[model samples]
Target: MTQRHIIRRVRGVDTSDGAGVKLKRVIGQPALDTLDPFLLLDEFRSDEAGDYIEGFPEHPHRGFETVTYMLAGRMRHKDNHGNTGDLGPGSVQWMTAGRGILHSEMPRQEEGLMWGFQLWVNLPAADKMTAPRYQDIDPSAIPVVHPATGVTARVIAGELAGVEGAVRGVATAPVYLDLSLEPHAAFDVPLPEGHAGFAYVFDGASAQVAGQELARGDLGAFSRIGDTVSLRAGDAATRLLIVAARPLDEPVARYGPFVMNTPEQIHEAIADFRAGKF
Candidate 1:
């Protein structure tokens, strides 16, 4: 018999505006300890232009990585390293805030309706100040594999169905996948051993895990998942982001966008960013 992976249903969060934009946080703002190895999660969903019109202005970050995964609409981003571009639906941008860097991202082309998830993954103390880099992944470039029974998976940062995403600069050994399961269909996803992962349903529908139901914006963490985790979609089907990260088992001392092992290092990162050293 397979042991059930009992998971706690942690609802998405809602927070105030920052970064010169109106941000409704989905995670990481209030519940810091809820998800170890992960930091922030922002859901920029808006159909009104005024809500996301301002967007995020130039800001500095250090010791962490910010991943922007777009669901709908577009985002124009630019960084101090002289790199600039935009991201449409299914596009992604991962920025490593090692040492320090300044960047900005604003909505584009939608008049509104910018839906995306910006995740913050913490780096181990030893690698916190390594260096900064960015990886822009296009939707078409990311492979989408369909298994039997209407199960679809988008390979973002790890192996899936023998296909993989081209996203480099990921140190967390994390596996990010966008999964969609048809009604009445089921999926058995295999996660690496000793890893921690969660699923955030976003299809506004219901999903069943060993008969337990979960709604949209509801996050579930498997406390004791085996190599494989089972999922079954409801009548309306299920859509969610399945994220798994390798446990770092290291010290985490974070301050704002910077994550380090010591407060002084965080202070130094800020000072360097201000002093143009990073």
Candidate 2:
């Protein structure tokens, strides 16, 4: 029998990021601590242009991967590696800042709603200094599936009902799914045994998880004892992002844009970035 993972905690996302852009930070806050192999999850949703216009200026990152998924508006990104791309609605950009990278993400539109999520996944010790890479995925390339009546899923990094996601070759073996459930609908997703998992509710009211209610803009971090997660929609429809990943279980040394295994490594990353070695 599959054990239903219970929601161990529920918390709100009230934070700001990248030049004053208001965002709902579901996972990276100090209160929640850190989920191994997954460092951060920030959701930015705003209709006012002033809220996001400043955007994320050029920044340096190392020893991790950043995954950006846009649901609305447009964002253009440029990296020091001469790679440039635009992210439209439903698009995804998975960047590996393995060794190091300097990049900027700025909004393309002056007005209108700009909504999206950015997730930071930590790399293992052996792969921390590997070369950077990217997986630029268009909306059309992402596979969508109707797993059951009134339920829709967009697979981003794992297989759902045998429908594979576009992202591949990730070290963490992550499962990222964008899910929508109608009123009173129920969905159960099987996860790899022992992987850490969580869900962030973005739209609608509540989700019933193991008999507990998780409200909007709230994150539900699951207990590690279950092989499957079960959720039931409230009276209204609900939209959420669910993710699971194998834990690295390694020491974490973080400073600003760098995440390394030791304080000495973080120092090296800073030195390399300042010396223009990225």
Candidate 3:
């Protein structure tokens, strides 16, 4: 028996920075509830300096992890911890905003196109106030391997090509990957037996997942599917960002950067941040 994939193509709106930086947000603020503990996802790819130069200036975040993966150009980032670095093509930075932190991502667009995606993953209630941490992974460190079907995969948070990523993250058992399928090629991505997985297609020109159809800018959220995801590309090569999150099975109460199980917990996060606690 084949179960129908309940898929939704969410057309995200365009948002402009006060500094005139333009980008598309798949999930944020108003879309927060839809993403649960995950607060937001932003895609900033631009050839014009005006569209990205503004960058995300100094901002505060707490109770989550922000994963920034660059596909092109460069991002100069600095945080309150005095940790500063530059992110170029294929680089990944996962900053765990356990307690609180202030940081900014400034564009160092030496090339024409500055492209990247930023995703916020929530922390479990017990670890919300652990500490602000980071995993600065360079492109060379990421696994870009081809196991089968002429498909190359970038392992970030899980296993691909039997080569897992080097990021030592939380215990939720999440999986994040950047996959590229050669024309007419196909492959299967392994996931936890009962985990939740989804594919976000930035270019929907020609792509399909787990026998389910998907278009550009579409998020194909899987239901009670199998453990592996089968994918194929069209005439042109296809690129997709795949992620699987563990089911916390707990209440999710969120307010901006703070994600807790209760309103008062969120309020405490705010007060703690204002008290210079990070």
How many steric clashes does model 3 contain?
Answer: 1
**lDDT accuracy of residue 100 in candidate 1:** 80
lDDT for model 1, on a 0 to 1 scale?
0.77
Tell me each candidate's RMSD, in Å, in order. Answer: 2.0, 1.2, 2.5
Candidate ranking under TM-score, highest first, comes to 2, 1, 3
Cand. 1 TM to true fold: 0.93
Model 3: per-residue Cα lDDT over 27-116, one tens digit each: 673543355445677788789887877787987887778899999998898988999999999899989888789888888864499888
Stretches of candidate 2 exceeding 4 Å from the true structure: none
lDDT of 2 by residue, 220-262 (tens): 7777777778878978999988898889999999998999999
lDDT of 2: 0.88
TM-score for candidate 3? 0.90
Per-residue alpha-carbon lDDT of candidate 1 for residues 1-278, written as tens digits (9 for 90 to 100): 34347467777665545544556565665543536677776777778877777778888888878899999989899888898989999998888878788888877764857788888888877777777888889899888888657899888887777776668557888889899998887887777776777777887588876456878877777654577667888777789888878767777777676678777877787788778886
Which stretch of 10 consecutive residues in model 1 shows the poorest summed lDDT?
13-22
